[model samples]
Target: MKSNRRQFIKISTLGTGGLALGLSSMNLNGINAAYAANKNEAVSDEDLTPYPTYCEVCFWKCAAWTYVDKKGEIRKIIGNKEDPHCNGRLCPRGTGGIGMYHDEDRLKNPLIRETKEDGTQYYRDASWEEALDLIADKMGKIKKEHGPECVALFSHGTGGKLMGHLLKAYGSSNISAPSFAQCRGPREVAFTATFGEDVQSPERTDIRDTKCLVLIGSHIGENMHNGQIQEMSDAIDNGATI
Candidate 1:
């Protein structure tokens, strides 16, 4: 009985060891296969022309280089080392920004909503000129009915600045940027109530120099604030406590 028990234990141990070895071998082979496949698809720098650009995926606006092939196809986006936002690393969204151009399901044209005789609504593609003309006609009718000041424009970004100018010239003082409200509205209000001034975007938090970081409800790493995440990493390296 004792000899049988010893044999059983040895066999079990050997079987487990063998299974682990087999799995490791399989994993190594899989990794080699992936490496070979990637090597075959590798593009040389000479084949790509890099253009300086900033990611529009999120508000971080991480500067990056858009590498295009000889055929003007956007191949990849690499973070610009000099950029203060990301340094030399782009977030997953920014890295995958090229996928936006390649996605077949992306909206490529303006669509106008039309109703069927039975009252079901569907959208039909329309030319850019037709869309612009329709918008202008609607705006004209609205201006005729109500004063231009009644036409409120909720907008954001650089294009929004141009639209704000157009609305201002049209005599509307009701232009508001929704981004400011969405991103920092509550924080702005709180800061104003407490400190008399709110911290602006591209906030100047000296995270790297801080010894202790207290996050009340902030999701710094998960929020994809590239600069803040990088600085937080440095702070952690320098013995900062969160």
Candidate 2:
């Protein structure tokens, strides 16, 4: 009876070892097949042009791939599939960046107003050095004569933020932005009053894991962020009502 029990134990151990070896061999065979297939597949240099980078066109700061041509010129931009923020999608503005870069109407150099008439202005080309000198002289004369308070500046967007910094550096207190007048100002004012914080871009909203989303006065359909738009579409596809 003891011999039979020992024999059973040995048989069980051998079966387990055989199974383990079979599974390992199967896994190795699968891996080799995949490697062989991949080795035979030809990948063109143009197809491999996309390289990882980051987008700064908006506050999203989405990770992206910049596709370059043979001449090393950027031909296209696409969101990185590895990015948690954009998740391999871009908005219309981000996609249109290529067009903007190649736009014929884009300003290549500094221009100065040569003549000003009733609601009309004519501009002429000027060197950056000459333009800066003229602007400095005029601003100095204005400050000396009418005081610094006489100059007021109105700006918009991230570019406006830079202008705000410039205005502060120039020692001007009369500076404002139209962000309040254009969009979500009342909501921002109320939220700030209640929470003691002002709303800002790239706000901390994890839309990916959210089951339900509520958009009040904000128009998700029109005034949409690329990430938000993609999230909304995914939510609908997953049978979550908007």
Best by TM-score: 1
**Which one is best on lDDT?**
1
Residue 216 lDDT, candidate 2, scale 0-100: 72
Instruction: Tell me the TM-score of each prediction against the true structure.
Output: 0.72, 0.64
CA displacement after TM-score superposition, residue 97 of candidate 2 (Å): 1.6
Q: What overall lDDT, based on C-alpha atoms, would model 2 receive against the true structure?
A: 0.64
CA-lDDT, candidates in order: 0.74, 0.64
Model 1 regions lying over 4 Å from their true place? 1-41, 178-201
Kindly provide the TM-score of model 1 when superposed on the true structure, using C-alpha atoms. 0.72
**Candidate 2: clashing pairs of residues:** none
Candidate 2 residues 1-242, lDDT tens each?
12232443454456546644754554455434434434543555555588788766666677888776555555667888777667787665465445545544457888998756666778888999999999999988988898877888897655777877777777788897766576657868876887788775544455546666676776553444667656655555555544
